[model samples]
Target chain A: MKHDYYPPGIKGIDGDYTAALAGNPNTGKSTVFNALTGLNQHTGNWPGKTVTQARGYYRHRGKTAVIVDLPGTYSLSANSLEEEVARDFICFAQPEVTVVMADATCLERNLNLVLQILEITPKVVVCLNLMDEAERKGLKLDVDQLADELGVPVVPTAAHIGRGIAELKDKIHSVAVSEILPRPKPVTYSQQLEEAIRQLETSLQRVYTNGISRRWIALRLLEGDHSVIEAIREYSLAEGKGAE
Target chain B: MGVDAALNLDELIEHGRELRNKLGPETEIQDEIVTSIYRRAEAIASKVAAQAGGRGRDWNKTIDDLLTSRLVGFPLMLLLLGGILWLTISGANYPSNALAALFFMLEDKLTFLFLRWQTPEWLHGLVVLGTFRCLAWVVSVMLPPMAIFFPLFTLLEDLGYLPRVAFNLDNIFKRCGAHGKQALTMAMGFGCNAAGVMAARIIDSPRERMIAILTNNFIPCNGRFPLLISMAVLFLGAGGLKYGSAIASLTVAGMVLLGIGVTFLVSYVLSSTMLKGISSSFTLELPPYRRPQVLQVLVRSVLDRTLFVLWRAVKVAAPAGALVWVLANTNIGGMSIIEHLAGYLDPAGRLIGLDGFILLAFILGLPANEIVIPTLLMSYLGAGALLELESLSAMRELLLARGWTWLTALNVMVFSVLHFPCGTTLLTIKHETGGWKWTIIAVLLTTGTAFLACLLITQVVQTLGLLF
Candidate 1:
C-alpha cells in the first residue's frame, strides 16, 4: 500500500504499524496497553483514571508497532469527554487495527463497546484481558468460541503478568497486513432502528465510495451525534459531494 | 399482538425500570431512549456471555454502600481526617524544629560573613536579616508539615478513598442544590485552594462551579498549615502532657471539619440565592479498592505538592522578610515602624483577643503565611537580632515572656482557620472567576467571617470567664 505522506521527523522502519488500543472503563484495558507496549502507562484501579491519551511503541519482527491508548469508556455514545475522544479517533483518524480491550471478568458489559466499534470498521482485534481476575473467581471462557462468535480474533490475556501480549501483537500485525480478514455478522438492533440504518446506508452508498461504513454513520445520526454528521459532511466534501 | 411485539413491549418496560433505578425517573424522553439502548445491549450480552461461579454484587458497590452510609460516613470521614492530622502534627514537629535550627545557624554564619566582607551595615541587615531570614523561616516552618501531610493525603487519594468521600458528600451537595462533584473539588482544596478552584471545572453547570470556586478558600491551604500547627501547640499544648500534640492535632482536625461544615452551609445559601439552580445528578463511580502505590504516591506528592507549595511560600517570604526588616528597623519617634503599626492595631486587636503585633503580623503575612510567626518575632526582638531557638520549650518561653495568653492562641487558631487566602490563592481565584468581582467577594467574605467569628468567640470567653 502506498502511504500518502510520512511524518516530517524521520526515516521509517520497514514494517511500522500504528494501532489504537481502546476499551470500556474498568476493563483492565491499560493493563493490555501497557503489556503490549512494554510501557508503564499508569494503571490505577479507578474508573475515569486515564484522562489523557498516551502513546508507546514496541518493535515486533522488525516492525515498530506504535499504539495509542484512548481513555476507557462504557460506550462510544459520546456522552462524556472520554467517549468523544475514543469515538473520534476510531472514526476519523482510522487506526490500522483498533484493538478493543475487554475485561474477561465482566465480558458481557465489556462487549457493548467492542460490538459498537465492529460496526465502524472490520479491521479490529478484541483483547480479552484480566483473565487472572476472572479465573480467581472460577469463570471459564472458550476463547475460540468467542472469536468465532464475533468474527474477529479474540486473545485471552492476563496482561498484568504479561501473558498473551506477543500473540496479541502478532494477531494485530496479521490483521493490519490483511493476512487475516474479519467478517463481523452485523449486530441487529430493534427492527425500527435497523430499517433506519439500512435506509441511511443505502442513501449514503449512492454518494460516497471511500469504503466508509454507512451503518455506523446511521446509528450516530439516530443517536443525534453532531460530530459524526460533521465527519460525514467533511468526508463527503473530500470525495466530491453528490458524486458517485 | 404477535409474540415479538409482546416481548419488545416487556423489554421496554423492563428497560424503563432500569433507567429509573440508574438515573432518576424524571426526564422521561431521555430516560426512555437510554433505557431502550441499554436493554438491547443487555439482551445481546445475555445470548453470548454466561455467568459462572455465581457472580455476587460488585465489590465496589458494597464498599460504596458501607463508606457512604449515613451512620458510618461522617464518623469515617472524621476518623480519617483526625488520623491524618495526628500523623502530620507529630511527624512534622521534630523536623520543623531541626530545620529552624539549621537555617538560623546558616543565617548567623551568613551574617558573620557579611560583617567580614565589609558590607555596609544597612545593606547587610537588609540582605541577610530581612530577605534571607524570612525565606528561611518559610521553608523551615512550612516544608516539614507539607512533606508529611501531602504524601499521606495522596496515599488516601491513590487508595481511591477520595472518590468515596465525594460519593458520601454527593447527597448533601444534591440536597443543597449544587453539583455532587463539588465534594471532589473540595477534597482537592484540602491540598491547595488554587487547585480546588481549577478542579471545579469538572462541574458542568456554571452556577455550581462558581459556588465551588467561591467556597474553596474555606478549606485551609498548605500555607496556613504552619500557623495551625503553631497555634495548636501554643494553646492546646498547655501543661505539656505526652498527648499534647495529639490534642493539637485533634483541634486542627476539628477546625477542618468546621471548615467543611461552613462550606456546605455557604454553598447551600449561594445555590438558593446568588447561584440558583436544580442539583444536576451525576454518576459517581466507586472504583474497586486497590493497594495504593506507596512509593510512587509518596514521591509524587512530596515533590509535586509539598515542595511546590513550600517554594511558593519561600518566594513570597523573601520579599516579606525584607519588608518586615525595614519596618522593624525604620525608627519613628524613638520606636520602629513595626512598633508604631502594632500599637495602632493593638486596641482593635485586643478587643478581638489578639494583640497589636499579632494583627500586624497577619497584615504583613498576607503574601505568605509561613513568615507570620517570624515577622512577629522580628517585631518583638529588634530586626537585626539573631533567633536562638535552642528548644521547643525555649520557643514557648519567648512567647510567654511576651505576655501571650490562651486567649491569644485561640484567636490565632481561629484566624488561621478563617482568614482570607494568601496572594497566590487570591490571584488564582481572580483567574478562575475571570473577574475582580468574585475575587473581592471571596476576600471580603473570608476576612469578615474570620473577624466576626473571632470577636464573638472572644466576647463570649470574656463574659463566661473561660480560660480562653
Candidate 2:
C-alpha cells in the first residue's frame, strides 16, 4: 500500500527541482528533453517511441533541475500502462513543474491531455512544439491567446530546431521557484458528478491532508481508480501512525 | 488512531464504490469524460488557430494514398523491400570480396610471424586459423551489407514510411488477433531479432506483445541474409535463368514474404491457444513525411546499429571458432570429434533433407548466425579451422562436390528461416519476458515448426521425384 509510483531507478536529489515532461506521443517530447538536459535519449518519428520513463538533469540559473520524461498518453484513463504511469507520476511525485507539450498542427487533439493535466495540477506550462511542421502544414497558433485561455504560460517551440527553448526554461524556473503562480482553469464536469465529488471530498478531508486537491482525489475515486483509492488509504494510515 | 483512520478510509472507499455502481459501467463514465475533454479542446483550438495554405497537407495525403491503398500498398511494400535487398546484395559483393582479401592477407602475415618466431603449430592454428579467421569472416560478411542496409532502413523510418506499413497491415494483424504494431517490430527483426524483441515493449497489451516477441524469429535477420542470398543464387538462379541476380533477388524477397506469412500463422495459433486474449485497440498516428537527414542517418545507423550488432557477433564468434577448431581436430576414435558427432546425427539430418554437417553447423552457430555457413564449409572440408570460399561460384562448386542438390539448398533456406533464434535473441526474450518459461516456449515452438516444415518439404519433393 506504499505510495511508490516513481520508477525505482530514478531518485530525485535533495536540492534539485523536479520537472515532468508530459505530452501526446510524437509531439517531440523526447526531443525537448534531450535539448534541455543535453542527454542523448533516442528520438524516433513514431508514436509510443518512449515506452519507459527516462530521467535526466539540467542546470538553469545556477540551479540544477531533474527532468523526468513521462510516457506519452492521450488521456489519464487507466486503459494502458502508459496512461497509468503518466497519471501516477503527476498525482504522486507532484513534480514542481509539469511541462505539457502539444503538437501545433493538431492542437485540438493535444489539448485533451493538457486539460486533464490542468485538472490535477496548476503548475503546468503548455509547450506548443513542432511549430515548423505546423507552419509548413499551413497552420498557425496564437501562443498568447492559448496561454490566456488555459490560464498558464504557453511557450511556442520547435524543439527539433531549438527555438523558444530559452523561454521554456525560464518559465520552468519561475514556476519551480514559486515566482510565477499559474491558476489553471479546471474542466467542468456534469452537475450530478460534481455533486458526488463534493460530497466525497468533504467526507475524505478528515483523513487526507496532502497538498493534493481533495476534489481531484474524489473524482478519481468516483471514477473507480483502484490505485488512487489505495494511495489514499496508505497516506491516511501513515498520517495516523505519525500522530500516534 | 491508526485503527480509526483505517476504518474511516475503508468507509470512504465503500462509499466511492457505491457511487460508481450508481453511475453504471466505468466505460460510460470514461466516455463522458473523454467527450467533455475533446469538446473543450475543440473549442479552444477553434478560438486560437487558423489555416493559411494546404500544400504540405495535400502532398502527405497523396503519398499516403499511394502507399497505404489496399490495391497498391502490399505490392509497393514488396517492391521497396526487394529493391533494398537487391541494392544490399549487389553493393556488398565488391566490398565483401575486398575485405576478405585484405583480412586474409593479414592472416598470412600473422602466419609468417608465427613461423618466423618458432611458434608451436597448435598455437599458430588456434590463434590465426581458428579465432582470427572466424572473426575475419564474420566482419567481412556482416559489415558491408549492414553498412548499406541500416542506413536505407533508417532512411525509410525517418521518412515515416514504417508507420504506413503498420497502417497497411493493421487489419490483417487484427484478424490474426495480434497488434498491428507487430509489423514495426518484425521490420526491426529484419535488422536484429534482439532489437525486435526490445521493440515489442511498445505494444500495450501484454498478450499481444508476447505474441510479437515469440514470432519475431521467423523473420530473417541480417546474419541469415548472406546464407539465404547465396543459396537462392546458387540453387534457384542456376535453373537456366538468364536474369540470374534479378531472379535471386526475387527469390530472397520471396523468402522474406514467407517469413512474414509464418509469423502471422504462428501468431494466430498462439492467440487461439496458449496466449488467449482479445486484441486491444490502439491509435496509430501516421506522422507526416519528412525528408530524411542523410548525414544523420548515416552517422546514427553506422554507430548505433551496424557497429553494435557487428561487435556482438564478433565477441561470440571468436570463442566459437576456437571451440569448432578443437572439435574438428581432436580425434575421438580415429575420427575427429566433429566427424563423429556429425556421423551420429546424419540419419536424422537426412530424414529432414539436410546432411550432418549442416545440422552440426546450426548447432555450433548458436552463439551467432553469421558463422553457420563458415562452420558448415570448414566441417565439410575437415579443415580443423574456419574457412571462407573466395566467391559464390567457388562456394557452389564446393557444395556440389559434396553431394548438394537444389533440394539441399531449398531445405537449408527453409530451416534457417524457421529455426530457433540465435543465442542473443533467446537471452533477450528471457530478459523481456522476465522469465525462463516463455523463452523455453519460444525455442520449442520455433524449433518444432522448423523440424516439421523441413520434414514435410523433403517428403513432398521426394514424392514428386518418384511421380516424374
Candidate 3:
C-alpha cells in the first residue's frame, strides 16, 4: 500500500483476493482505491485521463488483497480505450469483487455504469461515494433502498473524509468470500432482441468459459463490440483457432 | 454432442452478427442497450435518491462566472500564475545556492581525490569535470525550483483550476479556428508536451488535432520551465529578496503569457493555411472545485515532478555531460572540437542573437530539453567547466564574461520556447499522427519559428538601440 515498494510482476503480487474499482470521472473512484489500498494515485485532473492501469495492495482481515483501479469511464461501451480497459479487466481479469463507485450527488448517471457492470459480473459492490458533497449540495441518497433496487450491498461512503470506508471494506470482503451473493436485477430488452440474445447466450455458454456473464457477452456481440471480439481472441478462447 | 459442443467461436460470432442484422436497421441496438441500462439506473435512482434545495450550488456558479468571465478572468489568471512563479523563483534561490555550495565543495574533494590517486587528465576531466559537474548543475540549479514549482502547479491542477484554465481559453481557441479542447491539450503541455501532443486526440477533428499537435511546443513543459525561470532570474529578475522574487516571477509569467500568445497565433496560422478548418466546439465539463488533502498534495507532487526531474537528470544529463566533456576536451588543430563546431555555427547563431555554443547546445539538447542549459554552460566555460554558481549573480558573471548581453538571455528564453519538441515528444507526434510527414512538419515548423522570431527581435531591438 505504501510507495516505498511496488511489487513488480507476478512474483511481487500474491493477493489472496483481487478487487476492481470502477467509476465515472471525478467520482472519487481513486479516493476509494487510495483509502482501501493506500496507493497515492494521480488523483487530479478533472475528466481524468486514467488510461493507464495502476495497482495497489492492502491487507484486510488477515487476508492480503490487491485492488486494481480500472480507468474511469462512463460506461463499458468499448467506444474508447478507457472503456475497453475497464471492460476487459472486469470481464477477463475476473476480479473477485468489482466495486462500482457512484457519486452520491449524481446517482442516476453513475448508476448507469453500475447497471452495465452488473450485466457483466454478479460480484458487484455499489460504493455510493461523495456523501459529503451530496449533503452539502442538499441531496440525500437512501443507501439501503438503492441496494434493494439493484439487489446488491450499497455502501454509502464519504470516502474523502474516511466515512463509510470500513463498511465498504467489509462489504468487499463479504462479497469476495461469497458470503453475500449479489443477484443484480437484469434489464429487459425488446422481445425480438431478447430472443436473439437468449439464443446467443446459449451458444456463448457452450464456447465462452471465461467466467464473464454469457448474457453480457451476447449483448456485446449483438452490439458489434469489436473490443470484446479482440478480448475474446486475446484470451485465446476462440474454437476455430485450434482447428485451423 | 462432442462436435456440436466445440461450437466454432467464429461461427457463433457470425451467428450473433446474423441475429443482430435480423433485428433490422430500425432497431438501433446500441442505442437501445444504452437506453435500457440508463432506464434501470434512473429507475433505481428515483426510488432511492432525493434532491432538495441544493445549498452552496449558486456559490460555485458565481465563482466560475468571475473566473471565466471576459473582464475579470484573464487578470485573475495572470495574478495566480505570476504569484506561483514568484514563489518558485524566490523560494528556490537559497536552497539552490546552498546545494550548489555543497556540491562544488564536494567537487573540490573529488579533484583532490583524483590528484591523490594520480588519475590521468582525460580520466579526471571526463569523470569529475564533465559528468559529475553536469549532474551537480542539474540537481542544484534545476531540482530545487522544480521541487517548489511542480508542487505548486500540481496543487492548482489538483484543485481543479486547470480545467478552468481550459474553459477561459476556449473562446480564443475557437477564434483561432481550433477545437475548444486544444486549450486542454495546451494546458497538458505545461506538464509535458509529449503528453499534450498525445492529448490532442481528444480534438476528434483531424485538422484541429494536427494544429494542436504542432503548436504544443509553444507551451513550455516543466523541463523548459526551470530554464525559463533561471533566464528570467538572471537578466530580468531583481534577485531573491521578497519583491525581487515577485519581479522575477512576473517576468517568467510574462514569458509564459508570450508563449500562450504564440500558441494562439500559430494555431490561427495553421487553421488558415496548412491544416485549414473551422473550429469544432465541445462541451467542457467544469467540475466544482475541491480541496486536496495537504499531506497527499505534498506526497503526490514530490512523487510526480521532483522525482521525475531527478530520474531525468541521471538518465539523460549524465550521458549529455560526458559527450559535451569529450567535445570540449578533444583538441582539433589547437581548438577543441566544440569550439570548431561553434565557430562554424557562430554566424548563423549570431543572427538570432545567440552564439554558436548556445545553438550547438540546443541541437545537442534535442534529446532532452532539461540538458540544454547545462550543456551550454559546460561548453561555454570551455574545458574547465569549473564555474561555481553560489547564486544567480555568479552565474550571471560567467555568462557576461562570455559576451552575453540581456538580449542573449531574452533570445535564449524565446528560442527555448519555440524550438522543436524534445525527442520523446517528436516520437509521440510520429506515433500519434501515424506518419513521418506530419512529424517532420511539426519539427520544422517549431524550429523555423524559433529562428525567425529570434532573428526578427534581435534585429529590431538592435536597430532601436542604434537609433537611440
Q: Ranking under TM-score, best-scoring first?
A: 2, 1, 3
In angstroms, the error of model 2 at B5 is 4.5
Q: Candidate 2's residue-wise lDDT over B199-298, tens digit each? A: 9988988899999999999999988987887788788776557877688788889889989999999999999999998888887888878889999999
| DockQ of candidate 3 (2 decimals) | 0.43
Per-prediction interface RMSD in Å = 12.8, 2.3, 3.7
TM-score of 2: 0.90
Highest-lDDT candidate: 2
Candidate 1 chain B minimal-lDDT segment of 10 residues: B1-10
The model with the greatest DockQ is 2
Superposed model 2: Cα runs more than 4 Å off: A1-12, A39-53, A56-64, A189-209, A238-244, B1-5, B17-24, B105-124, B238-240, B383-388, B466-468
Summing lDDT over every window of 10 consecutive residues in candidate 1 chain A, give the lowest-scoring window.
A1-10
1 or 2, greater by DockQ = 2
Sorted into a CAPRI-style docking class, model 2 comes out as medium
Enumerate the candidates' DockQ scores in order.
0.15, 0.60, 0.43
How displaced is residue A166 in candidate 1, in Å? 2.9
Pairs of colliding residues, candidate 2: none
lDDT of 2 at B118: 100
Per-residue alpha-carbon lDDT of model 2 for A1-244, expressed as tens digits? Answer: 1225444534334436888899998899989999898962332221233455677777899998888788888887756778877876787678899999999988988998999889889999899999988887888779899998899999999998899999999999999999999988877779877788888888887765356777777777787776776765676676566667
For model 3, how does the per-residue alpha-carbon lDDT over B1-468 read when each residue is reduced to its tens digit? Answer: 324433457778888889988987524998898888878888888888776875565667798899999999999999999888888888888898898889888989998999999999999988987899888888888888888888888888888898888888888999999888888899889889999999988776788889999999999998898899888888776434556666778778878888899999999998899888787655566777878676788898799768976787668989999999999988989999999999999999999999999999999999889999889988987644567665557888888888888789889999999999999999999999999999999989999999999999899999889422
lDDT of 1 by residue, B1-468 (tens): 233333433343344344334433335434444565556556555555565655532555677787889999889988988898989888988998898888878977997898899999999878987888767767777888888888889888888899889888888888888889999898888777878888887776788889988888888777777888877876676566778988998889877877888788888888899899898766665655667889999889978988877787777777888888899899988988988899899898888888899888988887766678878776776633454654455567777777788777878878877878777778988987888999998888788878887899899988999863
